[model samples]
Target chain A: MTASDDFAWEPLDDVDDLEVGDRRELSLASGKLVLVMRTETGLHASCADCPHQDTPLAEGMLDGSVLTCPLHFWQWDVTTGEPLGVAELPLEIFELKQEDGRWWIGMRR
Target chain B: MIEVTVEDRAGGRTRFAARPGERLLHAGLAAGLGLPYECATGTCGSCRATVTEGDVGSLWADAPGRRVCRRPGEILMCQSAAAGGALSLKLPTAFRDRREPECRSLSGRLSSFRRFTAEIGTFSVELDEPVEHLPGQFALISAPGVEGPRAYSMTGNPSTEPRLDFLARLSGPGKLTPRLFSNALEGREVEVFGPLGRAALRPEDDRPFVAIAGGSGVAGMLSIVEAALARGHFDRHPSRLVFGLRSMEGSYLLDRLSEFVRLSGGLFRTTVAFSDEAPDPEFEAIFPDLEFTTGYVHDVVRSGLSSISADRPICFVAGPPPMVDATMRMLVVEGKVSPAEIRFDRFG
Candidate 1:
């Protein structure tokens, strides 16, 4: 399938008040950061960068609520973004939201 | 370098020049000889051969292949380089057509790089050549930024030429897969050495065939099913494919597998086991023909096939070390499938 080109922005009310199962993306020092709550889809998200070989997490699999590396099936839990089920190391999950239809993410603050 | 002569069971001998430090299987392959091997790094015992004459020594004492070598003269071709000169070895000698398939350096552009699950991607390489590989066999793939060559079994049948399909898993310490998919761009060239590996579907064995696979290992088993359907092997005996994954989403071949029931007129059956999650009803709705269970893969296989007392059936298994080892142990210890009938294709 071809990649999606359409972009949709949703606004979220509060960042700290966000409950489980909510996801948002915000800009940070590095770049655009994505934050996903583990309970929503029962999947974990990390830097989208494969830690072992630097593959994107976008190409991986999620099983047992764990995010498996698409390249080798190394796995991590989506809820905590902590590596689990197999392999080692945790994935970085950014805090995010949709504010007034605009996707806003939390940086360090 | 040590030179040796390999003799087939029929007394046909082929001379091979072995490298001093290279694994015997590597040397044989380099000498343009087809040597039986699965995980050429010494995990699978497919490369086991008997030393008919001369001395042989293993490079690694703790090599896992050592477990399958029983005969006084048996040694692992992947682990044992020739220690002395003028060696005579007896090939495992199966009834495979001696005309080995041509191996080509296939260059391709990676396309359709999408994640099948969290850790696996179902990708295809549009190859420059038409490569034919039997089910249960694999190809040696080389991609940019990945160290050395890594092997992956073809999920598509040999009939699909010029476009080879494969499923790759991303894990820490795994080679190549992560680098290839990460920062992906279109029109990048990837090299492939293919149509290699010997484990394949056996049309002659009329007994019920059993396939047990774990994770991406389902790639070859799925190909085996396709081959069986093409060759009418399923008409004679019902094929049972037992696949194990951590979740329903982690399993990639279920789309094709769903048609097994109708395609084989209910003769072919597929059972999937998830290690982590319970069966999803939606998944069952999509593939009503398949059976879903929550447990280890082998446990499901053992329970599901217990009633059938058929003998001399063909069993094909591929996966990680622990899963493969567990299945092999159960098949040997409980199922009592003869060693000759049990096939393994583990890379680790």
Candidate 2:
């Protein structure tokens, strides 16, 4: 199925390679970046840079769905990209889906 | 005069005046605006703002914080000054409602100085007026002829007396260190602005306190311990202090640590971690009360993480970037401590 025109599906990684409770950083050809997290429920993606001070969210501590930035301890929810704790801005969420046992990120179409 | 309008994410706006050649962060803080900032120096990208109108000039163009600015108009408020008549900037978040202590400019004279190690010196300044501050707050001090102010954490607890103490590691005969270490600096007047930084120990907190310091980073930890002791905090909550230094020859403040441990009656335990050497027999004899470990400070803390209760104990970490980063990572990733519980300041 074709995604909305606002997004284009871009291959990220194979579903088998990412274990549950794992996060990986991915960069797009357009220079857009996303941090992908695999949970028991599904795969979630958000902006790689933290909303607080631009710390790489890939380096953040992920406990369940909560992702904590390493720089100043700002946190965000990986599932919904909602700000948590001292974090004031929500992480920009990106659409992700699994196709043929491979994960793909939704980029701007 | 430059008119600065800072708009927070909540749609609230604060208008303040910025004097020429003054940092935007300093001007806003002096105007009583709760602008976000940590390490008013050119590090820790907490003070970043996006300029929607007018141009901004940076005193430290190559500030480390600049790397965090992902957009074209972003600037570090601590390093940027107004270069135009009017400027409008936007913050990514709302200003915190907590009232910040008033910031002001004060004059002080170097009252005392002593060499703690061959490269480290401890100094005291007697301000013209007493400045109130929390346990781990620091002051920005500019020497008579120094180009810019350097932030130094107060090594002693706040008191009614106008005297403040600091510990600094001399990088060499450089800008401010030479003047600070010089014998003639005693009685020389200097400019001090602050009582800045948010990592502090409050008197009402009951949780156990854990502090990790490296080299001169011990300055703020010393103040934290003093304040905690004054409030009888150690008597109720077990506290741990881990200090990392290169070797015994470069280590100072062991005597003070021993005295604090003795005063705590075994509640406050301290470990002096030597990265380069094991504790010598003579050194062990001299500091029988203090624990000696051989490793990086973060490694020492990691090894003993099981002993520390995870019931929301507040951790204060100060050191070089790598040490602070490693300790913070260990606490959050391995020890399962919340990031909110770890407090620290980063400098350029």
For model 2, fnat equals: 0.67
Off by over 4 Å in 1: A1-109, B1-13, B16-27, B30-36, B41-104, B183-186, B203-206
- Candidate 2 B-chain TM-score: 0.93
| Candidate No. with top lDDT | 2
TM-score of 1: 0.60
lDDT of 2 by residue, B238-347 (tens): 89999999999988998998989998898999999999999898888899999998999989998878865445678899988888888887887678776767878653
Best by TM-score: 2
Tens digits of per-residue lDDT, candidate 2, A19-53, equal 78898887776678788887777788889887777
For each of the candidates, the C-alpha root-mean-square deviation to the true structure, in angstroms, is 20.5, 2.6
Candidate 1, B3-43: lDDT as tens digits: 79887645667887776665677667656676656666556
Each prediction's Cα lDDT score? 0.68, 0.83
Per-prediction DockQ, in order? 0.01, 0.61
Candidate 1 per-residue C-alpha lDDT over A9-97 given as tens digits, one digit per residue, 9 for 90 to 100: 23333344444544333334455544443445432234646554345565454434555553334556675667653344567754444
